[model samples]
Target chain A: MPTMQPLMLPPLVIETQNLTKAFGQQKALDGVNLQVVPGAIGLLGPNGAGKSTLIKCLLQLQPITSGSARLLGREVGSEGREIRKRVGYTPEQDCHIPGMVGCEYVTYCAQLCGLPFQAARQRAHEMLDFVGMGQERYRKIESYSTGMRQRLKLAQAMVHDPEIIFLDEPTNGLDPKGQAQILDLVNSLWKRYGITVVLSSHLLHDVDRICEQIIIIARGRVLVHDTLENLKARRRGAAEVVLSGRHQEFESACLRRNWACEPLPNGHIKVEHHSDSLNSLLGLLDEIKLPPLEIIPSPNALEETFVQALEISHATA
Target chain B: MPLHDTSYQHWEGVHLGLWRRRWVIARAGLRACLQGKWMRHLIVLCWVSALGMTTVLFLVGQLLVANSIVVKWMGNFNPALQAFAGMLTTWLEQHPEISVRTTQDVLFYYFCIGLMRAGIFALGMAIPLLITRDLASNAIIIYSSKAVSRGDYLLGKFITAFVLIFLTWLGPVCAAWFVGNLLAPDWRFFWHSRVAVAHVLVFGAASMTVLSLLALGVSAISSKEKSTAAVWFMWWIFGGVLAPIAVQTQPWLRHLSFNFDLDQLALAVFRPAHDLTIAQTNIPILGDMLRGVRPQTLASLATPELQGAVAALLVMLALAAFLIRNRVRPE
Candidate 1:
């Protein structure tokens, strides 16, 4: 019999069991069982990959065809309003009331989340300032730039002081600097304020910058769900070693030493770090009389893994 | 210079109840409506009619009181005071029925007419701005994503429109009443005319509800303010034009006029004894044309006319509610 490990973290903020959602003949989410631990979790997927669908189902904004979901330990459909009271959402689309200044719009949103008028107004100002909106906060939302509008959306999401925030493509239309600022803001929400953030985005770099844990969904299924640190750590010790000369002799020497090696078209040999260390590899190279030019660790293995997961899922589907 | 803290902070404050939260939308909408220069100008213009009606009441009260005072002062009056007293007595005698109609009752009648007109204009100007703009901008999603429910949002919008119509309609009437009371000779007039106040309150509430429902329903279905306003205008014009023609071609269709139904309902609520079958004897301009041709005369007050008015109102209200409910969801 196998024994279970002792629990270390708090209960999950979101838990779904066989969550299925269908639209007519098309299945948007299929038997997705997800347990999201509290903190910053990235929902990574391509368009139409059920990322938004899952979020909507979990939020009770969309009804599931079958199965159940819970948010903050409360069942989704039955306790959606209760869940919404404690959760904030920034949608991917442009959602704004026309003829309203930024401060009033944020205040109105905060009020909609059950904040008192005075408190909502105060928090709206605070949130706008936090999002780097200054005197422009008094300008009509229709007059705001794309970056300003993005910041305003973020500010409204935070104005109610929700425990968890669902940010869908927060950095979607931003410039590089704007994207960096938004990612930093997302990070600070989890780090400084301890707010759980479920950031859904197709941008891997944005997720990589802010998310501690990632959930990659493809074809209505969760392909990968693990910590970024663990995913990156798994690729460690694997390296590509290049030789200036005697490449065939070096490749044969690596195989004779019982090391797995494959020669690339770029004259670099892909070497797996098994029992042998770099010293052993160097010794083997010396025996072949080939000088090592460069030994670079394989980069962006997570990206490769993501691509592999997508490809495998597509092939299986 | 000290750097402003741009860091995220936890909200330590408490939250209000759901209804209070819902009021936030209404308050914001009301503020936005009041902020518009066009809306402000329209409101001012509407109140100007109220002010004119109040001035008429004030003059009527002054004329009534002048007769008694002038009679008492006739024994020791200069030629100017005598001359003024004779003119006032002649005017008082000429319009003796005006005094018979209590100041409150007259004000109520004027208010009902004023409010109906103002309500139409306010609904046309404000509802589109309030609802269609939000729809066009896709702001309903932002609202739905928050703690506010669809029903709460719709109710908040209804309240905003109701309050605006109330201000334009009842606000002026109440002001006129206050002014009339101040200008009256004694508290007897107010005490005797308390029922008119009740009629005003009830009529205002009913009219406001119907108009708000209809405006909001139309607003919900439209994506653009201009489109909503245009549709509402066309609805009125079509109804007005169609109802009269239908009534002229087929007398049975007299009750189909939206304006006719509303007029009958207003009469039933505010002046139940006034028979629409007879030509209206008062009012100088449209009285001759309105006399026998009024749509309500086609059916007796106890028969289909009043029933049709009530039924039409109910059907309109139900239709508006249905449209509003369907369109208020997250898109």
Candidate 2:
């Protein structure tokens, strides 16, 4: 994960301030503020998390209820056409002209992206090759595999050579190999071209692999938005430290030492401390004369952090 | 970077890119219609059925040698055939030498109907599928490239629909003209009449243009499946086998019919002595129905002329184009 850095400029390609969307009485997005930098950023959320709603408003693909979005320094709805020219989008749902060949389909996209005829054709070929679909370039899209179609979708988004691309669940139905291939393609885009990517996925592992920054949303609100490292760092106190021999006495001592200590179900002392270092915790145990049978450091689990955030946000609501 | 001028130039480039996208769609649609196995079969079937209908009519005519039997069977079996033959023969009696030209002309008229039906149906059936396929396969990634805007995408689709309709009708009309000339050498006399040929061109351009725009309008309003179903259902109901039945049941509605418009307008133009019976009955009644009064002069119906049809077609196309913009939304 990249360290959170302060830049002279905003360092954001996309910014949404107090964004909200409602359908009649039902609110789909509620005061969601997101700032995305000029690289791969993952959008993680469960179903009905307002991820789709956010994407729609950002692209001006649908009308928003309130708030605002800016892409490439222009307001969303007013400058949607201009914003679209600088951004490529691969929708979660397939949009294809069934009988059109891959080559023809890509070329059409290239043209819509403003390449002239000869250039469109050449770019289409190059795009297909980049997606590893060169062999199937002339084959009709209706006959393509799910993975191939996904790749083609990505290719079309990239063919116009947009500065930024939004890939909405690009690996939704792919096998492991296919998913990896898509991930590699996405990674390569950022590395080779410095293209900003906003990848939406429900899979944490996938997001963790490609995204340095992430925005996790739930039920139409931003739950958390920060670098992955910062998110993990927030879970520091949530970590567990186990001491087997200490038992009840060690737990009481740790509680007195200003550590949140609990007697474990396994009859050990489990400690959680945000401010104290590992050495301080060890010194406290030594000062208490509680020699441990076994010592273990629990994993810094993000899943728990995510659930806790959701629970806290929901309870407050 | 110079912001103002360069930004405008970039935007223009994107708009042009959208037009390029439309050309891709048009080419794909044409290729699909021309090559798809089912579409090819459908076209072949239309040609065979039309020729078969003509052959059956000729054979039946040959079988009925006696005038009494022909008259009795015509009155009982098919009223349209009977009325058409009676009108033609009554005209033939006044100008017997011209009967051959009239006969060939009638055949050409029927051939044009079959041609228009086949062309319109085929083109209409394909358009919605094009829209649907794009949505289904997630192929719109190409359309959303930095070069394309939503408005440009809509325009591209409009062009595709218009061109498809044009070519579909053009192909069959040319074929029918060629075949009609070969079957009846007397058709040359009819073609020699500059007025006759001019009328044919006007009618052909008007009716087909109307049908094409209607197809596009339906495509814009509905999804691929719904668009296809709606167009075919309407075609079958309004222009196909049920058309005559509808006319028979509702004589008042006959004036609104495509057949009625063509027949009345043609009579008002030619006014051949042989067509006195039709000129008096079918033509005048249809004219009255359309104009809502007895014909003061044929010049009234003829005044606005085929130009009205052309204008109507252009308007429908523009409306369809506008509707298509709303229909195609971003993800």
Candidate 3:
């Protein structure tokens, strides 16, 4: 391992302070502040949500209008080469070299990241194999299928064995099976190899399946930044209870107990469990003489959170 | 549980420095260029001229040695061969100036022709394959995403073109020079002509730099190889054909042709000493025919040919660099 200089001390794997990017009068990234620790982090946003722009800015592929970003403890703009040596990026676009085979393309990428020729070649094969590209590795990139191209892209990004890999839409165009396979591969990248992954995608399920931490961005700003567990935990203890009889009486009884309640048209009442225990709610239901049919706890799904965040962001604008 | 062991293995190998990364790009590009059949054929053709020149030198050396067998054989030739031999002797005698005084002069001539042929090949074939293909595919993003910068990528492509031109230009000249020395009577010819070797190096280096920059600049602006190749041929062919016509009507238009400008530069760089006069009579008929189309009367031009060539080459290099700098970006 290379020695880390003391002057470059930063514990976070990715940190940005008030990062802003603008083109003429329009700003693409506005006062974005992010501090990410090393793990499987997900960047989720709708189209034109600045996810790709943020990744580019952090990679130093594009200059930021203002503010600063550091990756793996090195500043982005000034030390882009040094930072890139330790970080890998798979761009969203189809950026394959013409007339190069899969192995050759990956080997060239590894060489570009400062690996010697022999080492790069060896690593390229290993990465190709790991990506499940078998005999097809010898085929020219232009001849590969869409799935193979995505796999090849992943292989090239990981060929150097960098500390972290930024995957932008790794499953952009794929069937369900291919998507599942790629997601599985991404999950293993972190779980088995100890490599940190930052998966940027609009697919909530993909991020939910792979990333432990999530950052949702909307309209060039980060709407929410928290762990998936925490976000879901905040929405816990809320339940929708169905009634068999006396729905109005049950709603009145819940209101008297200071529980927030709203009766639905389907004879189900939504209630926030503010009391100490569910037993109390059971006792209150019994006292109301309303037969409880069913009760289901409603934890906030990542999809709902993403949508709500976008709505709030739009409303603010 | 995971479906498969898509594990990431740690790379325990040593990491190399960025100093030689540009060579990696150049090597890959060179390999890609050599893979094409047309480029390979052109490369082979580049050496054909050198071989022809070397054969001529060998025959001249034999004639100078007064070998009895060659003379006897010439005396017994058919009418056509006898007529050619008699004409050659008459031409040689009429122009006492038409003599290879030293092997250096022959090597310099071969090197100039070799460089020109190689420049054309590189501009037409190698530059398009190496640069335009990458741009057409938007592969610059992949290259720049790694530790390599945009400048490094451009420099790498430049080196690719430079190496191809070197092989096409200098490689043949060196081979011809070796043969010329070996065919000479003794080491005296080699010793006297040694300075020409440095001249070849300087001339080859300057020409390759200018041509590589110009080709790469044109490649940078255009995305498709075919479009770039068309633009390149149009510039060279039209400039060569039209500039002469324009210069005939307006003598001041001589500097308009890049080919003429490069030729002027070559003349200035390879200008022989005043005592070593050229043997024009000994040159083949084809050489004499081609000279009529080439720009003549370097001294009569409004500006010094050498200065105009240098200024034009520098301007081309600057334009190429500017276009490349603007085009090679991730955005």
Interface DockQ of each model: 0.62, 0.22, 0.53
Position A246, candidate 1: lDDT: 77
Model 3: CA > 4 A from native: A1-10, A239-298, B1-6, B62-103, B250-256, B272-304
Lowest lDDT 10-mer window, candidate 1 chain A?
A273-282
Residue-level lDDT of model 1, residues A26-143, one tens digit each, is 9999999989889999999989999988988887767789999999899988876788889988888898988889998898888888887788888898899888888899898889
Q: lDDT of model 1 at residue B245? A: 83
Indicate whether candidate 2 or candidate 3 has the larger TM-score: 3
Q: Arrange candidates by lDDT, highest first: which order?
A: 3, 1, 2
Model 2, range B69-151, lDDT digits (tens) per residue? Answer: 55557668877766665665454445533443443344445555556656666765665655555554444444543444556
**Worst ten in a row by lDDT for model 1 chain B:** B275-284
> In model 1, what is the error at residue A22, expressed in angstroms?
3.1
True-vs-predicted CA distance for residue B37, candidate 3, Å = 0.8
Q: Is the docking of candidate 3 incorrect, acceptable, medium or high quality?
A: medium
